[model samples]
Structures are given as C-alpha cells and as structure tokens.
Target: MQIEVLNSQASDINTIFQFYDMAVEHQKKVFNKHWQGFSKALIETEIAEHRQYKILVDDKVACIFAVTFNDKLIWGDRDKDSVYIHRIVTHPNYRGYSFVKEIIKWGKLFAPMNGIKFIRMDTWADNDKLLEYYTSCGFSFAGTVTMEQTEGLPKHYEGISLNLFEIEVNEVAASM
Candidate 1:
C-alpha cells in the first residue's frame, strides 16, 4: 500500500537479488534478449543514494524499481525535468497485481512534488509487448533511439535501440 525508498540494510540485499533472479528467469522464458542483471554493489549504491524503491503490499515488498534524475547515456540530456524510471522488477509471487499501473498513478502525485515534469522510462526497442503495455498504462511512446554512448549504462543497454515513454505531468492532471 505504500511506495518508499529502500534503505541500505544488509538483509535487503538478499531479497533484492532474489527478485532480480526471478525476473531474469521470467525474461529468459519470454524474450530473446533480457537484462544481464546488476551487481549487488550497484543496488547497494542505489539504496545508499535513495534511488531504489519498493511497493509494499501488506508490509511486504511486492514490486521493486529504481529511479534517477538523469540518464544521459540512454536519454542523451533530452529532458532535465524528468524522473527516469529503471529496473522495474516484480516479485514472482506478486504477479498479476498490475504494479506498474500503480507506479504510474503514484508518479503523477509524486513527480510534481519534486519539480519533475515528466515520468519517463525506457525499455528495449524490440520489446513489443512492453511497448503496448506501457502505452495502455498512459505513457506516450516517444519513439526509439540507439544509444550513442554506453559506458556508464547497464549491460543490456550497451548497443541497442531503446523505446522511450513519458507521461507529462500536465497531461495527467488534465485527464484527471
């Protein structure tokens, strides 16, 4: 019932990694290419930086994600007023809960409080199902871009076209 930043507790490390493995396993079954998974230290850094987050349902982490203020590698310094969403992984037992739609709704209320104008995210350009799903969830597809630089990006993003999605704050407010 709540979305909050994950704290850097040692116990959290195992749970997060477990979730990542579950996601990777699912991805392997469903997609030709998938996330290469992140290192525990990378997650530790996100936790320490307050970028990692979880959606708690009944006091348990049902879904997890990370957000960043800037993603110049994938986004190319396009929008300063954006919160870039990343690494959205759902707990296997929590599937079918529509957690992404929940995150989308939460972003509407949460983004503006921090002076953000856009709720932005990107996925592999080839992930058609995801593109359709995100579109159905209220994101506008902003076309795809092949990253020009990839050194600082995650492994999956090193040399691929990425589909961009964004929900402008004004648009959400207008609809509501």
Candidate 2:
C-alpha cells in the first residue's frame, strides 16, 4: 500500500471532489445526503495556507484527508502546532480495508514533522459505525456538539447532532 500526502491543486481538487461524491453515495448508510460543497472562499482559504492534503493509494486512490487548524468550529482549536483533520473520505471500492484508519495513523505520524503535535476530527453522532471506527483507530470521544442546526444546513434540521473526537499524536503513537 502506498500512502501519500498531497496538496490541493486543480487536478487533485477535482479528483478529491469526485471521490467525496462517490464516497457519500456508497456510504449513504452513514453520510448525510446534504453534505454540500465547501464554499469557494473556504477552499481558497485553505489553499492559500497550503495546508497538507493527505491521500492514501493502493494502486488507486483509496482515501483523501487534509489537516489544518482552521477547522476549529467543528473540531477545536489547540495551541500552536496543533491540527484538525478535515474531509477524510475513503473510496467505496476500498472500504473493507479500513483505509480511514490508515489515514489517521498516517496523519499522526506525519504531523510532528509539520509542527503539528495534536490532531482532531468530528463526525455525525448518528454514525455509530464511524465513531467506533475512530475509537478503534485510537481517537477518544471528546464531546458532543449540541448547538442548534445552522439555518442553511439540512443536517442540523434533520435532527442529527455531531459527535466530536480528538487524538493527541504523541498519545496515539505511545499507545501503538
């Protein structure tokens, strides 16, 4: 298996968007249908920072993930060198291999070199399967997001609360 960390660019962005769409369709059992596009501004903001775009490949694209501190509202803010994982998605065809787990492990190991010592991520509360998967992958449930759904997003109105998870890279590594 080949795991690579990529950056957001015209070619890779298109590929990542397509991968996300496919993953949502394939994992509809967990992903909400309303998962929408990140505003152009949001994408650009991250792009301007040149945030690390993490990808896992096993002959083909298996997963896509990006870690940055700005994903703070859902994931939280940590001190300098801290990071939050965003958009971690696994291709439908490679779901059984536990690709997301590998993505998380890769992030933990790669973070320190990038000045990131902690990593955080979030998921919907209803997605028990993913929650367990992250926990099994060494993430501990930090808290639940109880805020009222935002006006624009259908998920908040759909009555699904999100569960937040966090993992300290050193802690995760130590346990391993």
Candidate 3:
C-alpha cells in the first residue's frame, strides 16, 4: 500500500466529517462517552492554519487528526512545550493498520523539526485499552487530569477526566 501523510484541505471537510461520525458511532458502542461532534468553524480554522492532517492509502483518506501548539486547559503549564494531538479518526477500512503508531512516528519527526519538545495526546482516563495501547506505541503515561475549565473547548472535554500520554522529542531522536 502506498501511504502518504499530508495537511488536510477545506475541500476534504465532508470526508473528515464522515470519519468523525463513524468514530463517534464506534465510540458509542465501546465506551460510555462519545464525541459530541465538532463545530464546522473549528475544523475549518484548523484546516486554514494547516493544523489538520490526513493519512492516505493510495489517495483514499484512511485517517485524520488535528494538532495544536498549546493546550493550556488540559496540560496547564506544560502545554507550550509540546505538540498536542487531538481527534484522531480512522476509516473503518483501515482499522487494523496501526495508524496511531504511524502518527506517533510522524510526530517524532514533525515535533523537533518545528522546535517542539514533546508529542503529547490524551484520552478518556477510564479507557484502559487505549492507555495500554498508547504506552505500547512509545508514549509514557504522564498521568490523569480532570478538566476544570472547558470554555471554548469541545463538548466531549467538558467535565471529563483524561489520561495524558507524552513522548519527549529528544528521547525519540536520541534513540533513533
């Protein structure tokens, strides 16, 4: 399979939303909480800022995700030094392909090149499966935090406790 990672464009909004809807359906089946959906403006802004990304398998979108330079509401003081990953949605056809691992590999390279110190992501604190999966993918379980301030954030983040995962850029680079 030919795989390519590239920044998403505004025109891909419909496909992105399809993947997100599928993800939410999957989440509803497996978890107690599911994404409440993201605003069109929010996603459009990410696309315009080049913070949205997609992985394509032979030109078909297999996965999509967003990144932010800072996430003070969740990471607090440690936010600025990291690249925060959010809303990873993989197409059903690509479910078993280990795309999250690919994203991490991408982040390891993308971070330092952008002068970032760490690659960080978060999931529901109660998601034991994902916590284990992220650790297996080379992230350290940084801990859990209960979100106190969710203003301007997605609805899913409101009043939720999240499990933080991080991989230092230098650590990955040194090992490589």
Candidate 4:
C-alpha cells in the first residue's frame, strides 16, 4: 500500500467533517468528553492557509489533522517556537495503523524546515490512555493546564483542563 500526506483542499471539507463526527462518536463511547465540532469558517481558513493535512492510503483519505504555529492560550509564552497539532482523526478502517506516530515522524521533518523548535499537542487532561499513547509515540508529558482564556479556541476547550505533550525538534532526529 502506498501512503502519502497532502494538504487538504476545499473539496475535502465534507470528508473531514465526516471523520470528525466519527471521532466524536467514538469519543462518546470511550471518554467523558468529546469535540463540540469546529466552525466551518475556521476550517476553511486552515485550508486556505495550508495548515490542514490528510494522509491518503492508496488514494483514499485515511486520516486528517491540523497544525498551527501559535497556541498562546493553551501554551502561554512557550507557544512562540512551536507547531501545535490539533484535531487528529483516523478513519475507522485505518484504526490500528498507528497514524499518530506517522504524524510525529512528519512533524520531525516539517518542524525544522519551518524553523520551529518543538512539536506540541494537547488532549483531555483525564485521558490516561491517550497520555500513555502519546508518550509512547515520542512526546514527553509537559504537564496540564486549565484553559482560562478560550475566547478564540473551540468550544470543547472552554473551562477544560488539557494535558500538554511536546517533542523538541532536535530530539526527534536524535531519537531516530
């Protein structure tokens, strides 16, 4: 099977939303909290800016994710030198493929090329399984933070505590 990563396009919006909805349904079955859904405009902007990405296996979309250069509200001052990953959703057919590790491998190359110092991501603070999974995928737990200012963030982030995870760009190469 051939695997490729590419920026998402406007035509892929419906598929992306479908994946997100599926993810939320899965979350409802396994976790206490689930995504509240993202705004269409926000996604459109990410697409326009080339921040949205998808992994295709044999020309079919298998996973989707977004990346941002800034996440000051969740990360505070440390956000400046990092690329924040968000909204990772894998299609059910590809469930056991370990795509998060692929994203990390992609980030290792993407980060330094963009002059980023670290790759960062966040998940529900109480998600022990994800914490362990992310750690196993190469991230170090950077502690948790309760979001105080969620004005521009997704509704799910409001009044919630998130566990942060990060991998320094330099460390990625060393680990490999």
Q: What is the lDDT of residue 82 in candidate 4?
A: 89
**In candidate 2, what are the lDDT values of residues 7-91, reduced to their tens digit?**
6664466667787677666666646544655555555556667763645574466677666664444543443466777677777
What's every prediction's RMSD, in angstroms?
2.4, 3.7, 1.3, 1.4
Candidate 4, position 51, lDDT = 99
State model 4's lDDT: 0.93
User: Over the stretch 53-160, how does candidate 4's per-residue lDDT look in tens digits?
Assistant: 999999999999999999999999787878899999999999988989889888888887788889899999999999999999989999999999999999999999
Error of 2 at 160 (Å): 4.9
Report lDDT (CA) for all predictions.
0.82, 0.65, 0.91, 0.93
Model 2 ranges off by over 4 Å: 27-34, 52-59, 75-81, 148-160, 171-176
- lDDT by residue (15-115, candidate 3, tens digit) is 99998999999999999999999999999999999999999999999999999998999999888778899999999889988888889888887877788
Cand. 1 Cα-lDDT:
0.82
lDDT of 2: 0.65
Tell me the number of clashing residue pairs for each predicted model. Answer: 0, 0, 0, 0
- TM-score per prediction, in order, is 0.90, 0.75, 0.96, 0.96
- Order by lDDT, highest first: 4, 3, 1, 2
Per-residue lDDT tens digits of candidate 1, residues 1-176? Answer: 55443433556778888888898899999998878878878888888887877878777888888889998777775868888888888988888888888887777777877888988999989999999999998899988999878886778887789999998886557345
Off by over 4 Å in 3: 171-175
TM-score, cand. 4:
0.96
